[model samples]
Target: MTLADPAQITPLAKAPAQAAPGAKQRDVRLDFFRGIAMFIILFAHTPGNFFTSWIPARWGFSDATEIFVFCSGMASAIAFGRAYDTAGWRLGTARVSFRVWQVYWAHIGLFFAVATLLAAIDMTGAYDKVYIGTLNLWKFFVDPGPQLVGLLTLTYVPNYFDILPMYMVVLAMMPLIMALSRVHLGLVAVFIVGVWVFAQRRLLAEFGLADLHLGLPAEPWSDRKWFFNPFGWQLIFFSGFAFMRGWLPKPPVTPMLIGLALALVLINVPLSNIGVREFGFDWARDWRIANTIWITKSDFGLLRYVHFLALAYLCWVAAGDKGVRLLATGTGLLARIWQQALAIILKVGQQSLAVFIVSMFTARVSGFVMDNIGRDTWTVVGVNLAGMCVLVLTAYCAGWYKSQPWRKKVAQ
Candidate 1:
C-alpha cells in the first residue's frame, strides 16, 4: 500500500529541517531499505561461483538496481524539497550543484587512479597478461571518433560502466524538473516519455540530448548495457520524484498493496521464464509491442522497468509493517549483529558512490586474483564476505569519525 507523501502525511508545520545541523535521527525506513539494497547489490555482483550459484534464480533480484535508483531519486527529492522549504531555491541549487560536483570529481579521480594503476601493472607484468582499465582519456578525447560522438552529442554514449557522466546530466536537469514538478507532473511524465522515444532512433541526436545509454555497455550479442538509459530511466527517476510530491496515488497498506505484491510475484515467474526463453534474458531486446520500446539498459526496456516496479511494490509491502524491525530486535546475538551490520550498510549507502567505486575496484582486483591466483571457492567466499564486512565497518566508522566534535569544529 502506498503511504501518503511526507508532505501530505505530515503538514508543513511538522516537517523536520532538511538534515539539520545536529545529530538528527534519520528516516529509519529509508535507511533500512537502502541497507537492504546494498546487500542485494553486493550479492548480485558477488563472484559467480559455488556460493553464489546456489542462488534460487540469478534474475530474482534483477530489479535491485532499479529500486535503488528510484530510491536515490526520491532521496534527492527529499533533500532538495527540504532545502527549498528552508533555505530557498538558491541554497538548494548550490547544495545539489555541490553534490553533483562531488560525484563527478570522485568519478574522474577514480578513473585516473584506476587507469594509472592498470598502466603500472601492465608495465610491471604483474600478471600473465595485464588488463588495461577502460577509463582511458583517449576514448573521450584525442583519438575521439564515432564512439566519442555519442559522448559529444550526449545521446546514448558512455563507457558501459561509467554512470557518473549521466548522473551529472540528471543533476543539471534537476532544477528544471523541480520547477516543472510544481506546475504539472503529467507534463513531466510526457516530456520524459518523449525523450525516450527520441532516443530510439538516430535522429534528434544533438549535443546534450538525453542519452539512452545509461553508462552500460552494448554487447555484440546484447546491445544493452546495465539498462539505465536516461531516455527511458528518467521516467523511473521522475516518477519517484513526483511520487514524493504526492502526484501518484498512494497504494493502500491493506489489501491493495498485499494483493499487488502477490500478483506481481506470481506474474513475474511465468513472465521471467517466457522472457528468458524469448528474449534470452536480455532486457533491451524488442519483444515487439504496440509502441516501440528500447529494452536495453541504454534504452531502459519494458522488461526491466516492469520488473523494477513489481519488486518495488513487493519491497513496499515488506516495509509497510514493523515486522522487520521486530525481527531485528529479536533476542539473539546473531540478530543484534545483523542489525548492527544493517546500520553499517546504511552508512555505506549514504556515501554510496564512493563506496561503490571502491567496491568495483576491489571486485576487479579480486576477480583477477581468483582467475590467476587459484580457484578456491570457499576461500574466495570467505575472504570476499569478510572484505564486504570490513568495507561496511570502515564506512560506518568513517561516518562516525566525521561526526566527532573536534572534526566538526575544525570544518567550521
Candidate 2:
C-alpha cells in the first residue's frame, strides 16, 4: 500500500478534538514504546555488567541500538509529519532544526559534564579502568591516529556507543530521507545492505567514507566520540521510517517474521557455541541468528530490524483491539498515570538529548556511589534502576511543567 505524503496523511488531523483540542490525540503507544526503548538503552549502556553472564555471547538489552534508533526514526517521521500537516515544510524544518540543536547541545553539555566528573575521579585516583576510558575524550576533537579515523568520518569507530552524532547525520539527510521514503523504499533497503556490507570490510574507515565503526567502542570517552555510525545504521532508521510512511504495510501478528526470527536463533546458536575453531569460516563466529534477522543490539544488525518490525506489528494489533484498550485502562493507577502522561512523554522524548545526558550522569553517580559500597549483581541492578527512575521522573516532571498553559504563555 502506497502511503500518502506527510501533507496528505490525515489520521492525526482527523482525531477528535475533545480530549486534545488543538494537537492530535497523541499516540499513547508511541510514548510507551519510546519509554520501553529508553529503558533498554539505559540497561544496555550501564556498565555494572548485570546481564554479562546470562546473555553470555550477546550483549544485554542495554546495547539495544537498533530498537532505540528505529524508534527514534519512527518518532521523527510521526512528529515531523504532523507538523508538516499542520504547518508546512518550512515550519516543520525549523522545528526539527531546533530539536537537532537541542540534541547537539545536550550532547556537548554531557561531554563536558562527564569530562569534569572523570577528571575529578582521576585526581582522586579512583577506578583506574574507568579513568582510562575518560582519557580517550581527545579522540573527539583530535581523531587519535588510525584507530579513530572512523570517528572523524562518523562511521564504524569501535567503542563509541552514543547515537547523537549518528542522529545528527540522519537529520541532515532528513529531507532526502523523507522524499525517498515516499517513492523508493526498495532503494533505501538496498542502501542499507550496501552500507552493512561495506562496514564488515571496514571500507568506510576513511574520514569521508561511511565510517561504520565510529561508535562500536566500549569505553566511555572514545565511545562518545564515535557514537553510532548513521551510514551503516541508516537501514534500521529508514526501515522504521518506511514502516511509518506506510511503504511496507505491516501485516498484523503474522507468523512469518516471528518464525524467521526463531529460525535465525536456532541456526546461529549452534554455530556460535561451536566457535570459529570448529567452523571453517571464522566469519561464522559473528553470524548469530540475531544478525540474520537484525538482532544486533549494539550495531545495526539485520535480525534486530526484523524483531523490532515484528514487535511494532504486534503492538499495533494489540493497541487497536478494544479489549486490549479496556484492559490497559482498567490496569489501575500506574496505567492511568501513563495514559494521562502522554503530553509528558512526548515532551521528554522530544528533549531526549537532555533526558539521555541527565540519565547518564545519574547512572554515573549511581555507579560511583555503588562502587564505593559493592560490585555485586544486586548492587549493579539497584544502581541502574535508581538512575532509570530518576531519569524517568525528571522527564515526566519536566513534561508536566512544559504542558502548563501558564508556562507556555510565559515562554511565549
Candidate 3:
C-alpha cells in the first residue's frame, strides 16, 4: 500500500538542477483543492448565506483558510523558488518585491472597490441593512484622514480586509526565509519555529507570561490588532513552500496513516460547530471555550494545523500521485460532465488571485440580492449559483487576459 523506503523520494533540491522533460506540468491536486476552497470562501464571506453554516468549518476544527494559506505556500514554492534558483537571490527578491507591490495595490484597490459598492448601494436607500454599518466601515467613512494613512501603511486593517494584508506580509517574509535556506536548512527551521512561537504571544499571555502578541495595529486610535497574524500563519504557508521546494520529503501514503487521518477528521466533528448546535455537546463546547487559543483562527492554532494536515494527506491520497486520479473519468455521460467540471475547477484555481478578488466583490453583491429577495430556499440557491457563475466567468476572463491573446497573429 505504500513505498517503504523514504529514500526513494527525490527532493527538488537533491535532484539535479537541470529541468526534466515535461517538468512544467502543474499539480492538478493543488489547483483542484484550492478551487474548492475558493468556493467555500465565497460562501463563508457572504453576509447572510445560511448555507455557509453547513460548510466544513461546522464539521471540523480547520476550514478553507488553512487550505488557501497552505496552497498559497505550495504555489509560492513553484513560483518564487524558481526565481531564486534560476534568477539568483537578488533578482528573486526583486521578483518577491514586485509581487508584494502588486498585492499592496490590490489590497488598496479592493478596499476602495468594496467601499464604493457599499456606499453606492447604501445611497440608494433601498436596502434594509445599512451596508456600511454592517461591516463597521463607518469609522473609515466618517473620518478618513488618519485611517487613510493607516490603511495605506497597513496599520488599520479591518477584519474582513485583513487577509490580503496578512498575505502581503508573509510574501515579504519569503526573502528572509529564502536567504536562511541558503545558509543551512536547520537555521531556517529554527528561524521559522522561533517566529511562530513569537507569534503565539496571546497564548503566552493566557499563561500570564506578559508578552507582546504578533500583529500590525488595526487602527491608529485603537488597541485592536490585525485579525490574521502573519507571523503565525507564515508557518503553514512556508510548510507548503518547503514541501514543493523539496526541503520536506513527500509523505508516503500508508494504510495506517490513512486510518489515523480519517479518525482525526471524524473525531473533530463532535467538537465542531454543528456538533455543539445539533448534538448539544455542551461538554465539547466547554472544552473548546477552555482551549480557544489552540483552535483560534487568528493565531493559526495547533489543533487546526493538525486537522488540516490530516485532511490534506487524505485529499492528497485521494487525488492520486500527481493528481492523475482527478484527470481520470471513465467512459460515460457522468464522465463527460466531470471532465467539464474539472476544467472549470482547474481554471478557477489557476486564476486564484483574480478569482478571489472577484469572489469577494460578488459576495457583497450576493448578500445585497439575498436581502432584497429574502432568503427562501429557491432564492438562496439561485443567488449562490449566480455568484458561482460570476466567479467562473471571472476566472476565464483573467486567464484569457493572462494568455496575451493579443500577441497571437490574426491570420497567416
Candidate 4:
C-alpha cells in the first residue's frame, strides 16, 4: 500500500475537524539512507582495516562522504528551510548560527578528546607507533597556546576534525543562500557553481591563502587547509538541498536514462579498480587521472558529482514505491526483519549528529587497536561490528534522552 492508503482496516467513526497543514512530515527514506551511509563511513574510516578497500569509494568516484554531506544539506534544508518559511529570516539565521556553534564546539571537543587519548597512548611508548600521524598530538604538546587559538578560530583543524569546520562554514552561509534562493533559485545555483569552480581551480591556494599560517612553533600549527574545501563541496550540498526543496527539475525516468546511468556505473566500476590497472590496463589509470573531469575528492570534482547523482537516480528508480511501502508497512517475516533493522537505522539517523561524533571516537579507538594489535580478518570484523554496536547504542541513548518525560513536560 502507498502512504495514502492503509493496509489494515479500521472502524469508521464520526469525522473530526481537519487540522491545519503545517510542516512536512519527516521522510524516513532520508534517515534510512543516511543511517546506512553512517555505517559505511565508520567502516571506511577505520584505518588499516581491510574493509576500507571494500567501501563504495573503491568501485565509484563518490563515497560515504558525498552521501553523508549531501544528506546533511537535505536535512538542513528541511529544518532551516521550514524555519525560514514559518518564522522570519532573523529566526532562521539564528537557528543556523546556533547549529554552527554546536558543530564548532563539537569539533573542538572531538579534537581534544582524540588528542588526549592518543597522547596517553604515546606516553606509554608501548605501541612504537607515531601518534602525530593519527591525532596530530605533537603540535598540541609543543605549541598548545597557538594551536588552541587556531583551533578556536577554525584556522587549524586536525585531520579528522576537518569535516565539522567545513560543515560550520556551510551552515554559516545557509542564511544568505536561503535569501538568494527565495529571490531567485537560479541565482543561488549559479553562485554555488561559481564558488565550486573557483575552488576547483585552487584560486585560494594560488593566492597563498589555502594554508593559512598561524604564528606557532609547530609546523602543523603554522599552516592549515581544510581537507574537504567547503567552497567546492557546497555545490554537492546545495544540489541536495535544491532537490529536496523541489527547486530543481527532476529528470524523467526513461529507458534511455536508465541505460545511460547503468553505462556510467559500469565505466566507473573498472576505472576505480586499481587491480584492473595492475593487470595490464595501466593506460586506464593514466586516462582517468588525466581526464578532463579530474575525479579528485578534495575539490568535489565533476565526475564525483555525476557519479553520485547517477547512483541516486538509479536507486530512486529501482526502489520507488515498493521500497517506501516496505519501510512503512510491510509485514511478511523478511519484511518484519527488515522493518526492525530499519528502525535501528532510523534511530541512528534521527540522532545522526550525536552518532557521528561518537563514531569518530570509535574510529580512532578502532584505528589504535588495528595499529597496535591484530589486523587479521576476524579481528577487523569483530572490531567493526563492536564499533557499529556502540554507534547504535549511542543513537538509542540519544533518542531515549530526547524522549524523556521531563523533557516532554518542559517542552509542553
Candidate with top TM-score is: 3
**Stretches of model 2 off by over 4 angstroms after superposition:** 1-11, 14-25, 51-63, 86-91, 126-135, 138-161, 181-227, 255-299, 310-327, 331-351, 408-412
The predicted structure with the larger TM-score, 1 or 3, is 3
For candidate 4, which ten residues in a row score worst on lDDT? 1-10
Q: What does the lDDT read for residue 318 in candidate 2? A: 61
lDDT of 1: 0.54
lDDT of each: 0.54, 0.53, 0.82, 0.72
What's the C-alpha lDDT at position 236 in model 4? 83
What's the lDDT of the predicted structure labeled candidate 3?
Answer: 0.82
- Candidate 1 per-residue C-alpha lDDT over 171-223 given as tens digits, one digit per residue, 9 for 90 to 100: 66677765665577677777777766665433234344436423444322235
Arranged by lDDT, best first? 3, 4, 1, 2
Of the pair 2 and 4, which is ahead by TM-score? 4
Q: Report the number of backbone clashes for model 1.
A: 10
* Candidate 4 C-alpha lDDT tens digits along 188-215: 9788887787776444455766554211
Tell me the tens digit of each residue's lDDT in model 2 across 186-239.
Answer: 666666577565543233433546454433343334334343556667776766
TM-score of candidate 3 against the unseen true structure: 0.93
Q: Write the per-residue lDDT of candidate 3 for residues 302-402, one digit (tens) a residue.
A: 89999999999999999899899999978899999999999999778878888788888899999988888899989988999999999999989987887
